[model samples]
Target chain A: MIRFEGITKRYDQQTVISDISFEIEKGELVVIIGSSGCGKTTLLKIVNRLIRPTSGRVYINGADTAAQDEIELRRNIGYVIQQTGLFPHMTVRENIEIIPRLKRVNRADVEARSVELMRMVGLDPAQFLDRYPSQLSGGQQQRVGVARAFACDPEVILMDEPFSALDPLTRVQLQDELADLQARVRKTIVFVTHDMDEAVKIADRICLIHEGGVVQYDTVEAVMKYPANEFVADFIGRNRIWSSPAFIRARDIMIQTPVCASADTTVMRCIERMRTRKVDSLLITGENMRMLGIISAREMQTCEDRGVPVSRVMRRQFEKVSPDENIVEVLQIVNRGGLSAVPVLDEAGTVVGLITRSSLLTTLSRPYLDETEAATS
Target chain B: MNLFTFLVQSAGEIATRLFQHLQLTLLSIFIATALGVPLGVLISYRRRMKKPVMGVANVVQAIPSIALLGFLIPILGIGEKPAVFMVVVYSLLPIIKNTVTGLSGINAETLEAAKGIGMTRIQVLTKVKLPLALPVIMAGVRISAVTSVGLVTLAAFIGANGLGYLIYSGIRTLNDYQILAGAVPACLLALLMDFLFSLVEKMVTPACFKQN
Candidate 1:
């Protein structure tokens, strides 16, 4: 078990993490979720002695991390960062063999271990043994990063936003890969991310950090069901609704018959549809019903000057949420991406409906307002 | 100047010159690498000592090889001793600088990983740090080797038998053929040594060290 006892880290006069305490059992995956500057990263660094606490202690299997030789202490823990941090000059095989070589393992043993690690991380040894880090894509680089960390069969792993650099699809794939890898390796893992869906997906226990301390740490279901305070409620955002937004999908909240414009449709015609439907944006679809772009009502006023087709003035990079995505995820997608609304797409990537900022806000606010009304009554 | 006659006449001279050139250049580099690498490693670890050690190396590098040879002749006299001493001094900077740079350039993450794996200090240095530092150090050695080859040619000023003798003789007699003979072999030797050492560096370094 890894334990942090009253860990307090201060930078100058201000505290970054103050008197934080937690225990992670072997084979458990604990995730810390918080907004930026919430000290989740600082807390993980403290466990590895990368950043030492000012007044508290970290113990690995009951031995104080501060008291142990730092080098030896670090060797027992695997660390993965969002950047992957793979050594740029080394080949994938060499990167994985680093820890084994450091342990003075026999040459044959090191090679064998490297091959196994490469295979374990899903990189074919034959194909990638000589390939350098720069040659791999972002997702592949992260796999090599993971392989390097697990090189020595470390018992505990610390991951700080390891998959945050990848695209959403790649992020989801890697998260699943991580879950599988963790199940097999069974290392005590402390993962940090600001994404709640990712935290909920993989965490055996979730710790919600706020103002440099853990506001809530419990099972994923428990944390979602019973948030500790208003900060967590706000941080988790849209999930504190009494009906629990987890059960509501984007399809339920989305407008089924969304106003859409075609590529050949005139700008004036598109404006008429927006005005008649009273919608701020219209999805521009292609012949095969593929999403082309989104044209906002504001663009219609300047449509003639901006013109060629609806496609000319439409926003190509627009927010999209899947029909299967829960309302909380949709809200997160809207809020995090700073979009006023998002188009809900089916499995085929065709726009099914639209979800607006006001609809989501109403859905999220209803439960809290109802509670306030009950108190007043 | 018949080809057969030319070969028969210069065979002994060519053999003698080749052996001598190889002996002088190799001997100086061996000595410099032996002495400079450790000093570089030592100074690299101690922040305060780096400037002083590099200062000494820089001063040694600044001394012209002919001047150093001429100065050394007074104390050690003519022949291989003065020549070897001068080549060794000239080769120190690259070897020492590369060694320090190589050791210091080891990835901090790799070092942390090494420590995380339960390796002792000595184990980490020997296995992780030294192996990773090998390429940079080899680069240094390559520079030292080439520099030694060029500097050893100047050693002929002190009567040492090497390719330098042919160049000095050519200059004295104004024989273009003799000068070509000296200059060609020296350049070829430097290139040959570089290629050979690079192969050796590659072989000694594990494939993993190439990832970056």
Candidate 2:
């Protein structure tokens, strides 16, 4: 656990952080979010003594961090920054092995650890271990950054907007992978970002700072549902309709028990299932319940004439949403495509539910939603 | 006699002076690097000290080598010692200035990453900054070396043995052959040192930085 008490930093006459106090518990992921110049990065730096506080103290595991040697203290904490900061001259394996080698760990063990870490971060050890940072794409470099951070297996990891430099698609993919890795690894993490949606998605609790002070520090749900003040409300309320509880997801609003079929299943059987369910389309899935595509009645008409399987006639290109994706984004897809329904995929790419126009329309137009919908949007 | 006949006749004299010239340039640069590299590292970290130190180097560099060697004659006396000492002073600026540039030229993010990952101050300098700065610093060494070879011919004025002895003797005796013997070897020596340092630069360059 880490604790910050009355921590403040003043540069000349400008106070960048002022009397900010917070505590992060064991195995918890705390996100520090603020607009630029709010001293959020300053706060993260103080934990490892990168920046000394003008007054107050930070304690790690009950020992004051300032009292410890900065080098030794930093060696025990993992840090990942926005640029990925990988040494351009170092191979991926060498980059990850740096800390372990510094600790004088044997070469064989360090090599094994590098391979394991690369695997943990979803990089293939054989392919990427020898590549330099300049050779990899931005997202690949960031993944190497994360793996390098975890190489020493420190109990606490600090990530400062690690995904912000990546393109949005890669950013979202990394975020999902990070969340998945955190579930398996379970290290206490302190993430800092300016993105509110990211904070809502990954944080166990959020510390929202404004003007060198924390405006609100609470669980994701609490910060969204009950903002402490107008500043907190306004800062968080910008383009963040997804956080409010009144905002339904594709999973909740989807017609659960979606009439889905395995692609290998006969077209006649899929027609029978659709007839029984009174549906015009059937969701197609493959092994591990992965959604492959969809076959509508219009496209399936060719199956009889051509005597082909359903997979042959199924439409391969379509917009699919995850279970957590907001209904607003889903509504646009459904209305724009004139889709009878869109499939809701879980994190594993398995079809969890189906959101048809009527189902989403009724959910969006519900009288109870009007208050939050008006307020958040 | 033809210049080729003149060269063959004085080959032994040329070779001996060539040895002396090579000796003077190498010793001075060796001492300069030993002193200048650490000095550069020190001032880079203590940025305020940089301007004042660089000002002194620039002033030293502005003094013509002949005048500086002449100035040193009274205090250190003439011969190899004073000649070597003065050239060392002349060589320090390039090595020092290049070291400063090389160290300072490293990306801020790379340094932060090194520090953030818990490298000691010394480790960051040696393992990270020095390796990246090698090519730049080597370029400085190359500059110092090429200049020093020509400067060593001036050392004969101070009575140091080198190709400079023949050139000076040639001027006194109105003999172009003597001057050509000294002059040709010095030019060749400068080219040789430059070529060797280029090899050293390539060898020190990190693998990832090498272009395909």
Candidate 3:
């Protein structure tokens, strides 16, 4: 739980940060992202008082950070930097134990925590604890950096471009590990990065900043689907969400209108509606669009009694996806069962939209075609 | 008598002079470290003091050892006091300069991390800056120690007892054997100081810095 209020920083005649304000909820991974020189890093540093704001207030857990002693304030907050910032003189164990030891934590307790943290960050304690920072590869060094931040068990962690310096493969691996780590620890973390893809992958909420001001702060899905302005959309690249399939939800690509019929409708009448609507199946619904079941064209063709109610002939057990479910699960369900369509239901089982096979194909291919069209044009 | 008989005859006296020479060098080095390290650490943080402090040390280094002893003689009478003071002044430049260089040479990221992780200024110095800069600091001490061995030979000029006594007196008397005895032992002491300090340097150096 952290809040920034009217934080402004002026260096000489230039304004580095101007009247920026936002709040990060507890146990949420909020990413502050912008292009270089957009004050994202400066914003992160303000949280720990590494950079004093010219005029503003920062509150952590509702306590004003300025009122707290800097050393005491920082000891309770974890910090990780892009360079890994590990002390080359100290071994991994010492680096990780620095804060806890400074806090006068018991020797045995800190030592045990150092070992556990090493393991949590995917480093073996027995092998890595005594090795100096120079002995580790860049990725391993960053992992140790992460472990060191967690060693004190601080409630809030601040990470500034923690994975930006690593190679692409290692960066991806560290990002996944960080996301997993956050999931397990549930610390309120404020991560800063310039890359939109990374923000989308790991951030619970993305805070987009431009020229020392908040442009858009919303959930990853909301930000992706509805960018606030041209700068926000351009910065997040139109097809960026497509690269992260998880952001492509069922509601985003589903057909809002689907052919429907009352459950009491006779099979003869359902066939007439299907043929007229140019459909192969009908989603049978009760009063208020509540999903009843489905009756495919093939099922209707073999119906012995044409005048029977559609509910009696409909298949009750059917594959479905919620509007919020990502495209990956929708694809899996389609591939696994060879279903022609999947109904999108809301919390109350109301059939809001239909994700037809053709619709899924068009939604997934649009990104590629748009790129090619842009290239040719 | 020939050089052989001369060396055998003066062996006892040479041993005593050698001990005096070592004592002077070690004492000067010890004082230099005590003064130079803290000064170096201070200048590294109080950057305003760096230029003036380094300038003074540089001026001291520019002064010849004989000249430094000459300046000290009037203030501190003709004896071991002047000799030790001259050596300490000469040793200050390297120890202080190296200390500054070493401390400042520490990775900026490491220092930031030190503070970022909530270490007080003192803790950062003790835990990060000093430990990381140790090799360079020790290197300065080694230089000062080895050079001090040769410099202390000038102490004999200030009426101090050391191998320099034999060398200067024998030069006046035209006794080649006495000159050789003093000169040879002083040269060997310099080498020995280097060897001893190298061992210390290795011992204190972090494992990662060591070559396998």
Best by DockQ: 3
Evaluate candidate 1 and give its CAPRI docking class based on DockQ.
incorrect
By DockQ: ranked, best first? 3, 2, 1
Candidate 2 runs further than 4 Å off: A238-363, A366-377
Q: What is the lDDT of residue A300 in candidate 2?
A: 72
Candidate 2, A45-102: lDDT as tens digits: 9998888999999998999998898998988999998664888878999899998999
Q: Could you tell me the TM-score of candidate 3?
A: 0.92
Better of 2 and 3 by TM-score: 3
Model 3 CA deviation exceeding 4 Å by range:
A261-284, A293-319, A332-340
What would the per-residue lDDT of candidate 3 be over residues A11-68, giving only the tens digit for each residue?
A: 9989988998889999999999999999999999899998999999999999999999
Per-candidate DockQ values are 0.16, 0.46, 0.64
Indicate the docking level reached by candidate 3. Answer: medium
**lDDT of candidate 1 over A1-377, digit per residue (tens):** 98989999999999999888988888999998899998998898888887878989988889988888787677778888754366555677766776666667899988988888888888888998789777888988898888878877888998889898899998999898888988877889999999987887788998888888889989876776567887777677643434445756787778787778887787878888888888888899997678888878887786565436777777888879898899878878887988866898877879888898887877667777877887899
TM-score attained by chain A of model 1: 0.65
Off by over 4 Å in 1: A10-15, A35-39, A69-72, A82-136, A144-155, A180-186, A221-230, A239-377, B1-8, B102-107, B118-133, B169-181, B194-212
- Measured against the true structure, the TM-scores of the candidates, in listed sequence, are 0.67, 0.79, 0.92
